[model samples]
Target: MNEVEGRGLCLHNNSNGNLITPSSDDDLRNVFHQIRTTKNPAVINYGASWCRVCSQILPSFCQLSNKFPQLSFIYADIDEWPESTQHIRYTPTFHFYRDGERVDEMLGAGEERLRDCLWLHS
Candidate 1:
């Protein structure tokens, strides 16, 4: 992964390349707002730091992001953002959005399936 500094923020390509980790609720809200306003395709990985499966698929997820620069990738740790992730039933749940609407969702750490979903949406 690479770290790029921008606007005073040390933006690092987490396990998922191009992934952004919002430090606060406001930051998270802004990310969603930007996605909606820009109507860009985005994928959100709802995972937890303590989840073994979440950790296992991260490398592949990051590689997938690098493969698709047109898509916005984000990581939300359920442990840190419980209120925002209450609906999540499992770790490594991926939510795909396009044109400001969620088009598909996949649960679990299936790297191949995730890549296919991204290919289809992107």
Candidate 2:
């Protein structure tokens, strides 16, 4: 577990998922920058540990990351990074970005919806 800026959050590097947790405002900005600059599609899962739905769908989310190697997958905790989730209204919101722009957004923990968005965007 790699700590970022003493935020208590760890950036998981395990092979189970390539998900990244932005621990600070700058880190979050860098992630957005990468999403904008990268040619590949990017998806960010906005969630928190306390959210039951988030926890339930996390495994599926990680699986999706492994399933889609071409897309960049990220996990952002709304409680830890409020600024990054100002516009987020739901716990497990998935934002899809392509060509530096947000092409789609899915709210809730529905696996099928998430997969559909990924399939369409990624």
Judged by TM-score, which candidate is best?
1
The segments of candidate 1 whose C-alpha lies over 4 angstroms from its true place after superposition are: 1-17
- The residue-by-residue lDDT of candidate 2 on 9-48, one tens digit each, is 4444446455667767678889998888875688999877
Off by over 4 Å in 2: 1-17
Task: Please give, for residues 1-122, the per-residue lDDT of candidate 1 as tens digits.
Answer: 33222222223354434677776667777888988899999999887766888877876877788888889998777767667778898888999999998899999988889999999999
Residues forming the 10-long window of minimal summed lDDT in candidate 2 = 4-13
> Any residue pairs clashing in model 1, and if so which?
16-62, 17-62
- Shift in Å, residue 28, candidate 2: 1.0
Model 2 clash count equals 0
What lDDT would each prediction earn against the true structure? 0.78, 0.78
Range of the 10 consecutive residues with the lowest summed lDDT in candidate 1: 2-11
Model 1, position 85, has a per-residue lDDT of 75
